[model samples]
Target: MQAPQREEIHLNVPSYKKNRSGIAKFVVLPELIKSLLSLAHGNADVECGFSENAALITDDRSSLSDISINGLRATKDAVKFYGQGKVHKVPICKGLLDNVKEAHSRYQVDQEITQRILEKKEAIVAAAKLTKHKELVLVGKEQNLIGQRKILQEDLENVSKMLNEGNSRLEATVATKNFAGVEMAQLLIGGAKKKLDVLKTQLGDNSDQMNQLKKN
Candidate 1:
C-alpha cells in the first residue's frame, strides 16, 4: 500500500467530516488518518543505527564510554557502508590521513589541559590546608599566652600580699624596738617587690604576643 503525502491529507481530512453527518460517524477514519500523519518518515536508517549501537554493548563491553561507543559505531557503519563490510576495503583519503597524523597531537593537548586543571585543584586544597594549620597554631599560642598571663597575675598578687605583710611586720617590729626582726622584714619585702616586677614584665610580654597573634 502507498502512503499519502502530508499536504494531501491536511487538505482532504476536513472533507471527510463534511461528507459525513458528524465527526462521530467518521471516528475510525479520522483516528487512522491522525496515526498515519504522526509517523516520522525516513527514520528507518536512524532506528537501525540505534539497534546496531545496542548490539555493540555486550556484557564484556559494558564499560565502553559514550565517546568510545560512538567511535566504534562510526567505524562499524563506515566499514559496512563505505568499505563494503571490510576494513581493508576502505579508501585511503587525504582527509583521513591528516586526521590520523594529528590524533597524537590532539591527545597531547587534551592531556595537558586535564593535568593543568588537576594541579590547580591540588594547589587550592594545599593552600586551604596550610591556612587551617596556621589558624590552629595561632589558637594554641593564644591559649598558652592566656594561661601564662593567668599564672603571672596570680604570682603578682601573691607577691604583693607578701610585701604588704612584710611591711606590716616591719612596722610592728620597729614599734617593739626589735632591730633584728625589722632587718628580716625589710629583706623579705625587697624579695617580694622584685618578684612582683618580674611577674608584671612577663604578663606584659604575654599580652604583646597575644596581640601579634590576633593581627596575623
Candidate 2:
C-alpha cells in the first residue's frame, strides 16, 4: 500500500482527521490484495538476508557461515569492480552463473587466506628482529663487563709488583740495621699490603664472574 503524500502529512486542518479523510487507504481489491500477499511471501527469503546483516551490526552478534560471508563480500566487490570495469579483468569461470556464486566466492576466500598468510609473515619478521636486538644488547653488556674485568686484573698485577718492591726495600733497610729507616720501610710495606689485599679481592670476584661467563 502507498503511504500518505508529503502534502497530506503537512495538512493540519480540522476537517482532514475529523472527516476521517486522513486515512486514505481502506479496502484493497481482492485480486490486488492476493497478489500483494503472494509477492510478500515470495520476498520473505530476500528480506531474511537483512536479518543476518542486522545481526552483524547489532549487539546480539551472530556468526554466519564462511561461504555466506565470503559471497557477501564478493558481491560488494563485484558491484564496485564492475562499476570500475575491472570485473571482466578476472578470468570468468566456465558456467559461472550456473554454478551459483561459487566462481567469485572461492576467489574471495583464497584472497582472504593469502592476506592472512602475509600478515603472519610480517609478524614473524618483526619478532625475529626483536630477538636479534635483544641478543645485540646482551652482547654489548657482556663486552663491557669483560673490559671492566680486564682493567681490574691489570690493576691487581700492578699493585702486586709495587708490593713486592716495597718488601724488597724493607729488607734492604733491615740489612742496614738502622731503627729509623726500618720504621719508615715498615710503614710503606703496611700501606702496600692493604692496597694489595683490596686489589686481590676485586680480582678474585672478577675471575669468578669471567669463569661463569665462559661456561655460559
Candidate 3:
C-alpha cells in the first residue's frame, strides 16, 4: 500500500492513476507566466492617438497648448462617433455656439491667472537674491571690522608695555638723583603716556564699533 502511494505522489504517474489518488503535488511555476499574461497584446490604441496628435499638431500649429490639444482630440472623437468622421455632418446647436463664444473670455481669464502666478514667482526669487546679497555684505563688513579690532588690540598692548617701562625708568632716575637722566626719563615717560592714552581710546572705539556692527 505504501509503495502504491509513493508511486501516485511521483510526477510521472499516469493521469488516470493520479486522478484516482486525488490531488497531486505541483512544482512552483516561473513568474514569467504571470508577467507575460499581464502584458498588453498590442499598442493599437496608443499608436492611433499618436497618429491623430501628429496629424493635428503640424509645423504651423506647433505652439498648441495641452488644453488645445485635448479640445481638438475631443472634437475629433465626437465627430467620428456622431457624424461618421465628417465635420460638415456634425450638427451645430445653440449651446455649442454659446460655448464657442465664451471660449475667448475663458482664455483671457486663464492668461491673467497664469501671468499673476509667474509674477509672484519672480518676486519671491528676487527677494531671496536680495536677502542673500545683504547677508554677504554684512559678513564682509564684520570680517573687516574684526581685522581692524585685532590690529588695534596689538597696538594697545605694545603702547601699554612701553608706558610701564618708561614709568619704571623715571622712578629709578629720581632715586639715583641724576638731574640729566631724570629730565630725559620724564620726557620719555610723558610721551609714552600720551601714546598709551591714544591707543586705549582707539581700542575702546574699535570695540564699540564692533558691538554696533553686531547689533546691526
Candidate 4:
C-alpha cells in the first residue's frame, strides 16, 4: 500500500511598516493592507504542498482552500482590531493568515489538471497493449505510447518547476510587504506624535501671550 503522505505547513511574516510618520492609524493604512495581501498570497503559495502527489488530490490540490480559510480568519481579526481603534499589531498578522488561503486554492486547481493528463496517458498505454497487429504497427503504437509518456512526464516536470518558482516569488513578495507595512506604520505614528508636540507648543505660547496681555 502507498504510504499516506504527510504534509508540512509553514508560515512566514515580514517586517514592513505603512510609512515613517510614526502614527499608529497611518501605519495600518490601505496601502499597508494592499501590501499585506500581496505578501499573504505569496506566503500561501509557499506553505501549501506544491508536490505532484498533491496535484492528484482534488480537495487539497494547490492547498488554496487551507490558505483561504486562514486568510478569511486573519481578515476578520484585522477588521476587529481596526474597529477598536486601538492601533493593535494583530491586524497585519491576520492579513498574512488570509493570504495563505488564497494560495492554497490556486495550487489545488493546477494539481487537478496535471493529474487528469497523467491518468489519460495511463489509459492510452493500457489500451495500446491489447491490440493485435502487424509487427510494424505494434512497434509504431509502442513508440507513440512511449512518446506520450515522455510528454506527460515533461508536463509534470514543468508543473513542478513552476510551483517552485512561484513559491520563491511568494516568499520574497511577503517579505517586502511586511517591511513596507511596519515602516509605514512607524511613519504615521511619528507624524501623529509631532503633531501633538506642535499643538502643545502652540497652546503654551498662547497661554504666555494671554498672561502678558492681562498684566499690561
- In candidate 1, the residue pairs with backbone N, CA or C atoms under 3 Å apart (3 or more residues apart, or in different chains) clash, namely none
Q: Summarize candidate 4's per-residue lDDT along 106-198 as a digit string, tens digits.
A: 678867987899999998887776454444665665566556556645654554555455455556656777554554444544554555465
Clashing pairs in 2: none
Candidate 4: Cα lDDT at 10:
12
Residues 1-216 of candidate 1 have per-residue lDDT tens digits of 798777787667753554344443455777787787788878998899889878999889989778678878878878889789999999999988998999889979967997999999999999999999998998999889888888888888899999999999999998998888988899989999899888888888988898888999
TM-score between candidate 2 and the true structure: 0.47
lDDT of each: 0.85, 0.68, 0.79, 0.54
lDDT of 2 by residue, 135-216 (tens): 7876776787789878877877776777777777778877877656766667777877898788778778877876766665
RMSD of candidate 3 to true structure, Å: 9.2
Candidate 1 lDDT trough over 10 residues, lowest sum: 18-27
Candidate 3 residue 33 Cα shift, in angstroms, is 12
Residue by residue across 69-133, what tens digits does model 3's lDDT show? 99899998999987899989888999879988999999999899989999999999999999999
TM-score of every candidate relative to the true structure: 0.62, 0.47, 0.67, 0.21
Q: Give the CA lDDT, 0 to 100, for residue 30 in model 3.
A: 28
Model 2 Cα shift for residue 160 (angstroms): 1.1
Best by lDDT: 1
Residue 143, model 1: Cα distance from true site in angstroms: 1.6
Runs with alpha carbons beyond 4 Å of true place in candidate 3: 1-65
